[model samples]
Target: MVDAHRTFVIVGGGLAGAKAAETLRAEGFSGRVILLGDERDHPYERPPLSKGYLSGKEDRDSVFVHETAWYAGADIELHLGQPVTSLDREARAVQLGDGTVVHYDKLLLATGAEPRRLHVPGTDLAGVHHLRRLAHADRLRNVLAALGRDNGHLVIAGAGWIGLEVAAAARGYGAEVTVMEPEPTPLHQVVGPELGQIFTDLHSDHGVRFHFGVRLTEIIGQDGLVLAVRTDDGEEHPAHDVLAAIGAAPRTALAETSGLAMAPRADGGGIAVDASLRTSDPHIFAAGDVANVDHPLLGARLRVEHWANALNSGPAAARAMLGQEVSYDRVPYFFSDQYDLGLEYSGWAPPGSYDQVVIRGDAGKREFIAFWLKDRRVLAGMNVNVWDVTETVQGLIRSGRQIDPDALADPSVPLETLS
Candidate 1:
């Protein structure tokens, strides 16, 4: 008993697109649904590609959010390996690379971002890889296995999530790793410097070499093979392989071509989205990493490329498309599981702008939760291998209660009692 008339078309088969389609069905929308993805594989999780999948510990099948049969059973037509070339906004149809245009009543653009490439020379040399897609991970896995991780030198450029995850995965395979970060702290802009310092300590203790305030000038290679990477400081880092995880640029080419308004950020690229996740075009909507949703609390538009974001925003977009009113107000939360150290952080404080940093437990021993406060309000908190304090601490924060600095610093006093 499918409603065969009202057509709903979703582009991009990543987490956001897949989840949105599923939620549409669950909400009793039996309309004709078509999901188009560039990749042939089923909609899979990309987060594990940098960790579990790359380490050869997790298989690619485990990366999918739903099985192939789920799409078939849901009566949703899925077009994989078919790259859409252009979006016809006026006609409400998507033109595929194959010269076929698929029409729809409602269209969704969950097309995610693309990895920003290294501008330095020799970046195109062999043995230099970018970790964003499953195929990329598979290629890197084969390269790492052949290099015999125990002694291979992995020079990772950029201290972002992909780079750090690759470094941690390489270390899991016993590869010697060196990470080059232009910023002093890896999560400097996100969590602020204090909590970012604790992250540096955790990675450092894991035997990962980190260089801050440095940039790669040129990559040296021999006949298409990477040999060494030179820095702005006139230092050359020789390595067997290079993991370039600088960051990602929003895949706004299609949006840009469609004349949608691009959101401006002081740091550069991001696509603008309204309160309901609609773009400049009232007929279209966007989700996932590509769209910058305005932070309801901070009154700032932020683009988050975290798994929780994809999972949460997908349903929100689906609801909005269905003419239902909804708000994307979940405080941004992200986690990095490096070696045995566990890090979970929620919200972002103003940069270099915390009045006080309350610490529970000891960061020296690598067990503590740090809260950054501004105007006696909890702006952000980071739990380093300290799970017991997260829920309670986050509650106190959500309740908008001010916490005592001394009581927070003492491990003897549980964070819950302070409120």
Candidate 2:
């Protein structure tokens, strides 16, 4: 019942790759499906790595996308712990690290992204960590536990989501936490200053120290173990561990070397693809964090590194691979849990994109919905401690309707009536 002639090869066995393979089978494609991954573990989600898993609230088994046996049962050829060395675009094949060549009729690149490393010295030293992988989380979880027990200090770089979440987790473990950020406010580029102060207040109220407008200059260590970190401002803070949570850069080495088209660095660089997720080569396609897609709804080329993008784009790419008309236009979405404050943000409204930010409900009590509007059109929305309104928020973004700021801000007026 299998068609050996039509083989679909998926590179990078993360959630996107796994979901793409699953989608292929679910869509009745009974051909040869091969998945390759660099890590030994099965495909898993990355969000838990910084949230529940890092905090010791979730077990290791909870991270995997599917059971080990599911791959074989679904007739998916899975190669774990082996990374693809190079892509032969002309030959329609990929070379493995061990010099093995695997030919494919269609190729899907779900290579994902890697954590941006700090350029400062002492990064290679012991107790300096980055939280991008499961292994990294495992190590950081234990380090946090130990630091908590010893009443040690954690020096985190960057005030992004990962940095803020880790700061909260470190505090929960009873470890002293301090965050260093080059930006004036936390998540300045994402939510802008209007709401960045909310997160700053949230973390500060939990006793987390913040050093803004400074970059890490050096990391001082004793016996190769981090002792403290020095900032560009010439301030040295005692640190038992250092976490670089700056950001992630899309893994595009293979795509670049293979001569596939790439998006410009100014446009959030990644492998460039159209709405169908098709690359420069028709035989090859891309999805997830690695693919910079020309979004139909947003009318712009965008690269999203959030969990939702990976969750949805994988299947969309698979459908496209199967020769289906695919238009990936899902509104970008991401959620964060920092202490008692939990928020879900939908749509895209980076700095300079929106003209106004309207808030509904109480900001003092930490319960509010903030909407970013451009030309009176809802561009994005963030609901803090608000429940069951994701559909409405996303609907407003999708509709692209000009909404009254007063009605949008009033809790008395139902959001559904705005549309």
Q: Against the hidden reference, what TM-scores do the models get?
A: 0.94, 0.99
The candidate scoring highest on TM-score is 2
| Model 1 per-residue lDDT tens digits across residues 268-308 | 34668877888887778888888888767556677888888
lDDT of 2 by residue, 190-275 (tens): 99999889989999999999999999999999898999999988898999999999999999999999999999898899999999
List the lowest-lDDT window of 10 residues for candidate 2: 1-10
Q: Which sections of candidate 1 miss by over 4 Å?
A: 267-269, 388-391, 412-414, 417-419
Off by over 4 Å in 2: none
Q: By TM-score, how accurate is candidate 2?
A: 0.99
Evaluate model 1: give its lDDT. Answer: 0.82
Question: For model 2, which pairs clash?
Answer: none
True lDDT of residue 276, candidate 1: 81
Which prediction has the highest lDDT against the true structure?
2
